[model samples]
Target chain A: MSEPISGKSLHGHLDTMVLAVLDKSEAHGFEVWKRLEAQAKGGLKLKEGSLYPALYRLETAGLLTARKEEDDSSRRGPRRRIYKITRKGKRRLDQGRQEWQHFVSVVECVIGAPA
Target chain B: MQDLRVHVEKAVRPVVADQGTKLRMREELYSHLLEVFEEERATGDDEAAAILRANDRLGDPAALTAELQATASRVSWYEGAIDRIVHRQDETEIGHACRLASRYLLAIVPLIIVVVPTVWIIQTLIGSTQKSFLDLVSDSLWFGVPFGVFATAQVFFFTIIAHRMLRQFDKPSWRPRSIGGVFGLCAVSTVFLLVSSFALFSILTGNPRATYELMMPKWLIASSLMPFVMTGFVLARRREIERLEPWSSLEIADET
Candidate 1:
């Protein structure tokens, strides 16, 4: 697991991380939660309120598409809405990554934030 | 992905409260989860552990969705209340519409039956002093093919409306086609009878008033006295009626 990134690390870089996660395919709310958790090695705690709102905002931004499916109650579970990344989403993810990397370099060169 | 479908199918199959909505919700979640799995795979973790780790990080799927129970409860309560209000409104509106439509059809059919045929009959009775039945029929055919089409239209309409109205009463939902069919049918019937003779045409048209007047003018009297008729139709197909009135509170059992 990578060292925990600060909440500061998360502020400008969430789109990058989310795109990085969804890059492989579509993901629902839970997948986004899990991937984000794993990105920070379970350290970036995103409340559902924040995570979902962000996902929704991204969706409205033409980066993600959310769809609901019938989740039969498990022999003992419930139902949920799944989200997917579109082509525009992939492009944005790539752009976000490049931007994050540039921002990281600029910060490292000027502010000298620890890696 | 397929595994999630199986999970979703289980959630939907045996029937939970609000099962239809839950099932729809499950499919949406499954698509999202499948994407997560793909992302997990793409990160190039140890393939063997990736799904496990992803699942582990995801916490409990059921618990994740428990958030929906509150939403579901609220939505269901809203749905229930709305169902009643909606159904009541629908019944009032549809009932009013049905009554108005029936009244219009009744009056129009009689007017049609009497007027169209009487034009022909009066022509024949007046015997060439004025415009004749053949003149009107033939003149229309000048542009309209003069098949005595209009008189036929009257009869065809009358017969079909009588039949279709009976059917509409028998079934809760009805299409405009069911009623419009009377127009062409009565047209044909009128043409056929008018071809026979003046007396036969009058006989076929029957009573103009019968076609026009309401059998039961008072919905208050009729509706109050015969609410059971509406109840019977609604109860017989409870599921469908419920769907139509999503806000209805009636527990009319679906005919599974």
Candidate 2:
């Protein structure tokens, strides 16, 4: 597990992270969460419950579309709903990525990278 | 699994009153937790241990509910409160009635506060002609018109509010749609009829002088029926609400 990011730090970045996860392919809540955790090396400290709201908010904002998908794998369970990035979502993602890059540059300039 | 479901329901109920969102949330959470449990069990964890582990990972209920509510489209306080009261699963008919009455009563509080004094001041300026203060209030058609208009307007406003609140924030399947206007009309009518009958009987049997004064002239009585007509209007509006697209299957594909 990677070191968990503080809740304060995670606040604004969650939507960006969620959209980036969906940038690869459509995935349900669990798949998106697993990929996020893996990417963060378990340092993300993202709560399962909190993750859902981010997905929902993004979906509500028209940045993503969600549809019910039947669970077809051997591990039988209730149907899972997958979220796919909409055209709007992609545009927002690009905006979000640019904003993040500018933010990182400013912070790095201020604090200076590890000597 | 049962524990997970109970946790999810408790966490989600207050925040997501809409049936479609609630059901989808519950299913999604349950499926996620079950997967966690299964993965734990595969790693030589016992069933109880897996369940315990999965439950812990679900997070704080209050925080989660708040997070979800914050992110979703905002529902106003009255809308959410009225929605919960009307659509609650265990509420009985009596309970529902009381909740609705209290809610409507609260909505009318400002009008009552304003109207009573305004009427009193108007009467004071005009100078009291009747024997008692109560008689002054009871005998005047001028006071009655304002009271009736304001009160009827309040009823109309609240009826639309109730309909809009339910239609926008709650799913039809959670509470019976028929509860809105028809049931309210029947209840109001029953009370109105009983009181009017009692008053009519009292006037006929008890006092001839009182009969002439309190029975009201035919024209006034006809005008007084405006509230009932407004009630019919509210009922028709509720029927219109019934035809609104169910929030269950529909998705907002775009902001436009």
- Measured by lDDT, the strongest candidate is 2
Residue-level lDDT of model 2, residues B1-256, one tens digit each, is 5666666666666674444466667677778888887878898988888888877787877777788677545444454556665554456544555555555555565565576567777767788633454554455534444444444544544454444334432344434455555456544544454445445445445664565466546435654564456455555555334533232223322211
Cα deviation at B58, candidate 2, in Å, is: 1.8
What lDDT, from 0 to 1, does candidate 2 have? 0.66
Q: What is candidate 1's DockQ?
A: 0.09
**Segments of candidate 2 deviating more than 4 angstroms:** A71-77, A113-115, B75-79, B86-89, B93-256
What is the TM-score of each candidate's chain B when compared with the real chain B? 0.28, 0.37
lDDT tens readout by residue for model 1, B1-256: 3454444333322222243454444444444545555667788876556655545444444544443333444444443333333333335434444443444444455555566567777767868446666666555345332223343443444434444334443334443334454344444444443334333333445653443343324423443433344334334644444332322332322211
Docking class of 1: incorrect
- How close to the true structure is residue B100 of candidate 1, measured as C-alpha lDDT? 38
Q: DockQ of every model listed?
A: 0.09, 0.46
Q: Please report the TM-score between candidate 1 and the true structure.
A: 0.33
Q: Estimate candidate 1's RMSD in Å.
A: 18.7
* DockQ, computed on Cα atoms, for candidate 2: 0.46
